[model samples]
Target chain A: MSTNPANHSTPVNTAAGKLAVGWALVGVPLAYGVYETLTRVAALFG
Target chain B: MGFLDRERTIAPAGFNRWLVPPAALAVHLCIGQAYATSVYKTALVKHFGASLTEIGLIFSIAIVMLGLSAAIMGTWVDRNGPRKAMFTSAMFWTGGFLIGSLGIFTHQLWLVYLGYGVVGGIGLGIGYISPVSTLIKWFPDRPGLATGMAIMGFGGGALIASPVSTALLKAYDPNSGAQGWVASGDAVGKLFLTLAVAYLVYMLFGAFTIKVPADGWRPAGFDPATVKAAKLVTTENVSARNAVKTPQFWLVWVALFCNVTAGIGILEQAAPMIQDFFRTSDGASAVSAAVAAGFVGLLSIGNMAGRFAWSATSDITGRKRIYMLYLGVGAVLYTVLALAGSSTTILYVALAFLIISFYGGGFATVPAYLRDLFGTFQVGAIHGRLLTAWSAAGVAGPLIVNAFLDAQGKPGQLTAASYQPALLTMVALLVVGFVANLLVKPVSARFHEPRPDRERPHEPAMEA
Candidate 1:
């Protein structure tokens, strides 16, 4: 029987990549919030 | 179906703990729809030909149920990992939206209440607490900051949902008349449908991605000995049932109740409060609806920023001192707003912003405060019980504000002077909370669970 390499956990940079993904998840929403606020503020001034 | 089982939800040694916040955020952002109920309040009232109070009851039920379910479900969440809990939350929340849509489409108001209020509120409750204990375990070094990020999503969820709900309503009824811009019950029904579909998918990300940290896991290089436990900060653990038996829990409850009630008083009527406070001399209003909406938008930012910033500050200043600032300084800010708010627009916004920040701070810091008093043994459950303060405040806060305002005159007809009574009342409420905060001590030793022989290994060392 051949052991599937993809099925096994590798001692590579996994946590860092997961951590970066986490930051991106939060960042997308935060960036959208900024855009929403900016437009709302513009409407107030407009 | 087995894909989301608990075996899949354990954090591997090399797994990034940071991934947990966004998972929590995903659930919170969906449940936060509870805050955006006002968007549909008018349309529902028109559809049912009911009083504004009747429509308002929908939101009230949801908030009440949220508190109840959280208290009830907290222990279950603590016992099970976040995966099963979040999956349950997603199902109920999505089901609430779908059933609620059916109610609107069928013109049955009770169905809306049962669907959105009862079922969905449970979703909010479980969803709210589901990720909390996980975040605390993951960020043992910064529990306040971690929980704040997720809870902040609860505050900001309304911000995202409000606009999306409005846009959907507009698309559903582009030719809406002047008297009713939200279209009608049919549009609202469709809106609920869209929301249910979108949220179910979004919440799946959280349910699938979230994992409980391995038992006894701590952040790297962080020592438990380094945290000098103050007299108020306990080193022991207390079960949720035992936690309720402590004087400290009740004191913290009173503190949270007062803080939420006062802040919610402002939050419930932020737009009208500002407009009424600074009404023009000639009788025309100074603040426009657009401007009021803008103000609400700005308050959302303040609420969100305060959650992250103040809770992070609590990590440094100590949870007790940050709360002291929330209750103590909160009183001062409210008083200033009451007195000077009538004349100075700048002071009004500035003071209101500061007051709101503290309000948000109270929410973000309290979980960490609970951890300080009761150990993580059942912190989620205890926090669940603690949120009843918010539920009670949800009713009490708006009542205090509205009752005072109505006694003076109608909402729009009243002047800044009319708000003085309510504002002053909030200051007094803050004083009560401040006293409660002062009285909080460590949970007594009687409540501590005897240390077990072997920590319950949730894992069985089997391959899934």
Candidate 2:
């Protein structure tokens, strides 16, 4: 249930900031994975 | 700074709801380690000298408990809200890992089940729904995208955990020989403790960071009319109690069950299926274990991507249309994967990737679908009940895949031919789900609460 708004916008993350943070959460870790997988793949080829 | 204080969680007028997703992600990413149960499965099998099935049951019990706890604790989540739910979740999940680690060290099998399976399962369920209702409330204009953001973390959670856990296990016991650093139960126990601490810290960040959207909050320049105009996207609220009584709920449940079960057809057998499908000359050699691992990784990427991509797309295409794509189009993908066989490596990879994406999409999309049909009032609880479908699929998918393969009379070095029947069976399951999705209609007005209760409802009256 929603209580009354304090009427002060906290604006913690700008729209762009929100999108950036959202993707970064997934992207940073996934990048780690991609790098890891590539390392393994290279070993397979080697 | 007091994380569990309810008053502290109220969003100010300018509170940007976007911060919520990262918070949700914090919890989900940690719990997603449950998917990486394989990271320790072999170690446990060797350490305990247990059958693979016995080791595998840890995952099963956790999954089944996830469904049960989510269904049972959903309303509690709604009443107490995400902050408390997430805090509670952190304790159980992190505690489960520690307790489970102790089980490994003690060589007690049931402790693993009790700690990881039962207790951790409770954490999984609570953590899963902790953000659903809050996200729905925050991003009313984009329910699908809101849920996708957090649920995608779940789909992607294992990506982070798998490597981290493996590295930790290795560090604990580097002298593991050819079997690698995975043979020692002590290392596994220590790894569990490491994970428990790491996850607790991350999830605490989530609980601390999370705040519910203010009452009656909406995005800038958004019009409620635009959403109300969509078909089957209701403006009415339905109690979780009444929601289960509705036909639409059952339809969505069936649809999710089928989607998950079909996806597990591959997920439950990712390694073996890949090796079997691409066997070498005269069936003497299959794909290397490394390649199979790579294939699983590829599928994981697809899975995570699908959760975001498809769920976001649902914002524009509408939830119903996306389910059509997931079920109707997914059946076609299964058929293609089955017919295409092990013909080419690229073909196999491509088809499996697509199927897995839809699988992840199915999960991320369902919460939004529930919000559409049932309203945010009880969407979390409804979503919790729906996860029971996942529990059922967890068992059914493996059984179907393994049984069909087993009945074919080959035990070892299974070929591409071994998977045809199961894949076809997956196609059939998708067909059944497609029909179920087709049957989903708007919840009838009779089930809707008469008034939109703005405050959380009081605890139920004791039945004498």
Candidate 3:
């Protein structure tokens, strides 16, 4: 599907800023969790 | 409260579809904390001076409640929309932590059961399915990728929660050790309060930001007819009530049940199974406790990654073909592990990791699979009912593995030879899943619901 934000008419909540913030809210924490788990996983090779 | 209504959540014409996934992730990440209960299991056991089984029951109750609440409330979620459902889920989930915290402070075990197990479980159930259908609607061209992103959060949630909970317990209890530290009950109670507040904020953010695509809205350049032309892809709708009557639904359920049961067998036993496989004749293990833990962490990564990577692959390969790989290849992996898994630790880890990835794939792909067979109309509800298989497998998987192990020998003393029976059993179960996936045909025309004139502007009308 087209990855562009819907541009047919006036956008409602689809602003570029809002999309960045939304992704950050969930992404930062998920990334942190994965990072911590990876640190532990390093022990297997060590 | 009105802000949580379905109509209020409809996306405006220019709303970015990409934004919806993060909203779904917010809820899933918070609810996925359910899997991290082991972080505090020992602390609760020490605080209450209870048996291991009693503390374990808290998680069991939560999982059982997750399946039950999802099945019972799925239709309600479908009718009410994602916003209201997410709001309700946040309330129950955080409230569960609140009540559970109170139970810990008061040293009342039953209260913890009521709070975390029953109340929080309902939250897990609702929050799990809430964003699924909306995500599907937003990305009709790539339903697997959309649902995979959200459900992947569920697996990732525990990854964050495990380490986070440990750190919180240390902060709450100054005496908590770096190794084998069991926080005091008081510290655990405080930890719950913190999680309750943190999760509430995250979940509410998700509920507020989430939006349903306006009816008849398809992504630009996405044609429903193209989707329909694919094998088993349907543009027609099916009511949640009638979905249960179809053979396709049950076949999928059986397939999921088998896949999960086999996967859980490995997951539940991962840490010890590794040590046992490499145990020396002198009764010492080559794998250390710390390394065994790393193995578990590695499996979590596999589990989380497969949810996204394999499920996204389904968009191109088709759901049926992807499941064939999961079940068919999964059975072969199990046999290899059972026979030669003891030969080398690296080999064993690779086999186990791939099997767990397929297990995760089974979960992430099923919703899209349902959409293919049943359509979007009540896909969330059907997906919810299908989760009863997960709850059953949660029980059956451990039971089957443990029963075989018990017959062979005791827990800590058993070797790879003892695990062979259970491993072979899982191999047999995956074969059952493979056959079930083979039998899944499209939902028959007699079961199709008449298309609503307002809903499908781009597709042909259904016969019924």
Better of 1 and 3 by DockQ: 3
How do the residues B159-179 of candidate 2 rate in per-residue lDDT, one tens digit apiece?
888888788877888675654
For model 1 the local lDDT of residue B161 reads: 82
Report the C-alpha lDDT of model 3 over A1-46, residue by residue, as the tens digit. 2345574233443377788899999999999999999998888989
- What residue pairs clash in candidate 1, if any at all? none
Residue B127, candidate 3: alpha-carbon lDDT: 96
For model 1, give the RMSD to the true fold: 5.0
Q: What is the DockQ of each candidate?
A: 0.31, 0.26, 0.50
* Cα lDDT of model 2 by residue, A1-46, tens digit: 1354563233323545765765576468756865775565453334
Give the number of the best model, judged by DockQ: 3
Considering the true interface contacts (CA pairs under 8 Å between chains A and B), give the fraction that model 1 also has. Answer: 0.32
Best by lDDT: 3
List the candidate 2 regions with Cα displacement exceeding 4 Å. Answer: A1-27, A38-46, B1-5, B177-181, B452-464
When 1 and 3 are scored with lDDT, the better candidate is 3
Predicted complex 2: CAPRI docking category: acceptable
User: lDDT for model 3, on a 0 to 1 scale?
Assistant: 0.93
lDDT of 1: 0.84
The digit string of per-residue lDDT tens for model 3 on B88-108 reads: 999999999999999999999
State interface RMSD in Å for all models.
4.0, 4.6, 3.0
